[model samples]
Target: MTSSQEQFVQKEIQKISLPSANTMRLLEINSNPEHCLQDVIDLVKLDSALTARTLRIVNSAAFCPLVPINSIDRAVSYLGEKMIVGIAVTESCGKILNQPLEGYESPAGDLWKHDLFTAFAAKEVARYAKNGMEADLAFTAGLLHDIGKPVLSKLLENASKTTIDALDHGEAKDYLAAEKLVSGVEHAEVGYQLAKYWQLPAPIAAAIRFHHNPSEAIEEFQPLVYAVHLGDIIAMMSGYSTGSDSLQYTLDSHYENFFTFSSNELTKIISDTETAFRPALESLAGKEEN
Candidate 1:
């Protein structure tokens, strides 16, 4: 994006410092299953709104709580270790989710809604990949994967509206291309910076950078990063206009080999995504945003 656009992203982001040191400490618990379930509740209790948001998610039907999950601790146990981290990050990325992206076709909160579906799709891919990587990290990474678009858009706020207009018409080659022509850095690079600044795990930051180019995935994070790449693509194919990436985005053949799907299965993913749409959007909306 143009230097002005880059400034816009930086200006908005600078408003919010990274989460408190305590929250960064919580981000670490994500790597360990043994600690994830217990520790997430402790982390969220520091922010009452997040605690309440997480509890509601755990009590939702996808989790099938035996009883209404009455507290963060119970909710954490019900969701188990993997889910706790996913829920926490989902809660953590609220600002990114709610923020505006001028160049994206999506309307207010629409991008965030699509991000939620992508997270769900990523979780499904991880489960089916059986890649030893935890699903929550994949989910959170997928959900916030394109967060830098907003940063870039804001950066371009006062510039001419043509770039944003092209994005609305779906004519931009990709966000990175448009962003580069308008601003110096692309969303991926900006997002990578934001993720690191937020103290997100390295794998997640890596995924953000490579979600559009899984072939570039570093050796340490390949399979999981690849899973998120496909997950976000599939999520967009299912018809949520969250990003410039779409069915048009290339899926790496090497990585596609990892997951098997028949036409029937493909149909089911679309069906599941459609079925979950309103509810998922409502879930995010109902939460008291941070």
Candidate 2:
């Protein structure tokens, strides 16, 4: 990619819509330990769509709450701040992520499914890895990791067939390289720019930017990035709502050298992720129904 083309891609990214203000406020509350429960309820109530989505997800068969949750306040109180924020993040991006991206052969809702699976997988991997990494952070990184894909999809919609062929043929070293060759910018780079624009934490932004190539991530953020990368690969390997880019990228050998997980450990992580993903998959089905 040339410098001029890179500049053009950056300019296009600036034009992409961001998460809603209500969701942004919810994220802020989630990050602050001092925030009270009432703060979450008040903000959530401001967005009826968010309120309904939250209630539906909380009341889903997966959660299996002992008692029914009819109100946003009660739901927030029951699920606590972290879970609520996570839900808010997913809900806020649902419309954008759920859209079909013909460029990537992702039908409506497929990318969202892949994202949720990856998020849960990342959380499980972090738990098994036990590297003092926060599961919620890992989950967030995984969920938002591929956000740039949709943006690129839009660009590819009108791209020349030659460019699309290049992407499909593995002409470059890897998927990112292929993307860069054809589009002048890779999804990870675009995702990072969007993350910064959204004012997300540095670590999360770094993870999104470097998930496909964790070794390139800054030393301080490498572990988190590696966790997300592993989670993404595991999700793809397990055939969890994979998209056109599913097998296009190569797995980094450094992941094995860095984490040093035995075969049994890897199998256990995949199994645990599948268990966790079931409820999420069910919830998505429920969403489609409504």
What Cα-based lDDT does every candidate model obtain? Answer: 0.66, 0.75
Candidate 2 is scored at a TM of 0.81
Stretches of candidate 2 exceeding 4 Å from the true structure:
2-15, 28-52, 70-83, 158-170, 256-260, 284-290
Off by over 4 Å in 1: 1-9, 20-23, 32-36, 41-49, 56-66, 80-91, 156-175, 243-248, 273-280, 287-290
Model 1 poorest ten-residue lDDT run: 281-290
- Summarize candidate 1's per-residue lDDT along 107-215 as a digit string, tens digits: 5676676677777777667766644667776666777687776676565555435555555677666655555666667778888878866767787788888887777
Stretch of 10 with least lDDT, candidate 2 = 155-164
> Residue pairs in steric clash, candidate 1?
1-179, 1-182, 1-183, 1-184, 2-182, 2-183, 5-155, 5-156, 8-155
lDDT of 2 at 98: 80
Residue pairs clashing, model 2: none
> Highest TM-score among the candidates is held by which one?
2
Global local distance difference test of model 1: 0.66
> Over all chains combined, what TM-score does candidate 1 have?
0.78
Give residue 181's lDDT in candidate 1 (0 to 100).
Answer: 62
| Each prediction's number of clashing residue pairs | 9, 0
